[model samples]
Target: MSVFDTACGQVRGSGPDRGVVAVLGIPYAEPPFGADRFRAPRPRSPWAGIRDCADFGPVPPQSAQLPGAPSWSPGDEDVLSLNVWTPAAADGAAPGGPLPVLVWIHGGAYTFGSGAQPDFDGAALARAGLVVVTLNYRLGFEGFGHVPADGADPCPPNRGLLDQIAALTWVRRNIAAFGGAPGNVTVAGQSSGAASVACLMAMDSARGLFRRAIAHSAVGPCYSPELAGHLMEKVAAEAAVPATSAGLAAASPQTLVKASDAVVDAYRQNPHSGRHHWDPVLYGPVADGVHLRADPLAVLAGGAASGIDLLVCHTTQEYWLLDAVGSSAKVTTEEHLNRFAADFGLPDSLTQGYRGLMPEAPVGDVHLALYGDLMFGEYSSRLADAHARAGGRTFLSRFARQRGGSEPVAYAWHCADVPFAFGNLGEESIRFLIGGAPTAADHHLSARMTAAWVGFAATGEPGWEPLGASGGPVRTWDAADTTRAPAPGHWSDSGTVRTLWRSFGYRPLRP
Candidate 1:
């Protein structure tokens, strides 16, 4: 049933059980198609009648090769839509009372992903006494490509970021009617989603839309204007068209998709030739003057977002899942070891250091640990340290519980903590990760973690002290026990590892 009608003439929603929810998929801006295809987002037209809020609206155009599932096109161009979940009836939630609102942005490396993934069901989070919202924005070339204009003030790149800002603005204006506290909002996301949260923190347009943020795997890399232009040119050449909005927009969607796929295929075959050696899909945020002032790490190091509370973390065995997928050939010899070291940009000394640490471990296991630390651990630790240095309230954690059925050595891989965080331990994806069925211990940890997350959204504190506070504490969640203290040896020594990483030019990438 409809809960409330938004100013844009879209009906906000409620869940099936009659519990309070307002799934508003209002268009914050006009469709990015036709003449507006690659231009900056413009304000939506004011509407005259209530719009239906029955099903998820069209996802932004993206590649079908997104991780974790098969992708297919769901044809429609109204891609700018948002879904909201709340706890009170539309008309009569105390007028000024505040309830925390959590806004989730999905991750797909800036090219693919949607708010409609089964794993990101906001129902559980909403049921736990908070309002949850998720939304879709443009992707691929449509969201990021730049076109020259003859205006006095040129539009900076990063139209995807602009879409996110627009969505947040919509929340600021309309969420309160669905029992959400416009003043107590929290922005949370994973992977590129986390990167988007970091960008939002740095963007002036996003200020005051949310009071706190939870950035899981927060990335710190952005594309330079030259680099983005080069990639766009390559895509245009592959499509046999001029590198302009008019030229590319005239091509059919299938033709554009094929051209993009061909470019990625070529890169995959000879990675060193392209700008994105490792991933063709890595089109991150750009440092356009208006949307992003500088790289997020630099901004964080300079105490940006100092006033906001943050919960930032990483999985312990972050790279094992990728290894399991990419290299079925187990690392068995020193030759294999050396190859992996070069691939992941591990320093010779650091590789030696890990070799010493795991003298008896398999070469593959060592490689997994090394890459995991490089990709997630060091960055997460640095983020915590940066937040602490900036005078922001930051709570850091490491998920160490190994999935049940997999090899005991697998540890907590990427996205492993999501099920526990959302209290969906029994879902198919969660069960696949945890093996068979979730035990009582799983339920307990889920409740505790979700409570901590909800608590963070509610207040600046997340049931733990900041990493570098006077108490010098951080949380560690495991199956055996969950506790907080001066971040155990693992988190504290990340700076040393990070230093070693820098020597090899293995910079931490953020968006």
Candidate 2:
């Protein structure tokens, strides 16, 4: 074991053969409880003594309520904690060291997830000569719920995003102590984490904190303020409580979580409502003239962050992991496809285009593919294309390896790249998804992926061509070998899909 005294407090971490690892759970900001609840994060009060960080900190007060998923007890008062894995003490290494830093943000649709998940262990990445850090942030109602018309605070909701910003700030201040280059940081996340990275890219607060970013399965849209406010109103109504600051302050954490769950259930049941789901609260990260000045996609289209290097991509069969109506075996018909498309606001011509391409495929496949393209594939390409057109360095990729022997054969499903990215392929969670243990091929792929990630953090070059450069290609990590080629037509077909996203107010800049 090793220990370090950081600015916020004392942190204890585990060490490996390479060097000492110091995990810091310093509170970058105050707990968003009591009067401060439902408002933007405020700076944490500096502590007097060494605060022990030997164990993982408590997660935010959230629904201890997963129906069938495993559950664990919550922790200490400070739910905002960060875990770090480094090769050695920063002072021990040379100034402006060559070692890169990879800061990971776990994804749970901005609702649930912790950095302590076993699959996120950073030992392997540290062994590969990079520092790895993960953190916990407020979630669910505590992190995203909006205040009433007569709320006490002026900042718009997106407290969770604010927490992320605080974590990055922490990284900037003290990563050097862990033998990391403070200026050479890469922020990466999956799903909502990816969306958060997109938010960071557009957030003025996050500017200059990290030099590069990697967004896996990044969402193309964010909640509009009007939509988010309406959802908050509905949540308040469902809880049979007033939408006032006092009423919310008086509400219990459990009540807020349950109410938010009810809202999600209602939205799922009535997909035609045209309302933002629980994940993207229409009020989340508004163009509030502050935190997020504009929509992420819009900012990218306007050449914002053109100087930040980006590595963005999505998994193949992105929606296969979702237990929604479209992924079911029973929904393998044209009727089902049309219904799903209607719910997703996809055009008939687009549906027909998918059918024409995969004529012999199952209706369920076509249905999933249509929505998948609309939700992930197209948007991912547009992000790469947009950044490239703006003269930023960008590389795109697709995870194509299918976890063998699973019933549905998850084909690079949602979040499938996480374990591989962290080189935790043999962990139990990863084994369950990949069916048994990861083969030798999986280990090789993990090494390549980790190296690419660390390399990008070090020099903003991800071992691939820029999306709009002369080569304009992608590096595909497959079972056979790591290779590069021009992005295939299927991956680069951005025209029609770009139009669809633009309808949602996203303008894609083409090369």
lDDT of 1 by residue, 118-172 (tens): 6677777877778888888877776776554434235447888888888888888
Output the number of the lDDT-best candidate.
1
Instruction: Report lDDT (CA) for all predictions.
Output: 0.71, 0.70
Model 1 Cα shift for residue 380 (angstroms) = 2.4
Q: What would the TM-scores of all predictions be? A: 0.88, 0.89
lDDT string for model 2 (246-283, tens) is 77677777787778878776765654544233122322
Q: Which pairs clash in the backbone of model 2?
A: 90-177, 90-179, 228-282, 228-283
Top candidate (TM-score): 2
State the lDDT at 377 in candidate 1: 70
Error of 1 at 143 (Å): 2.0
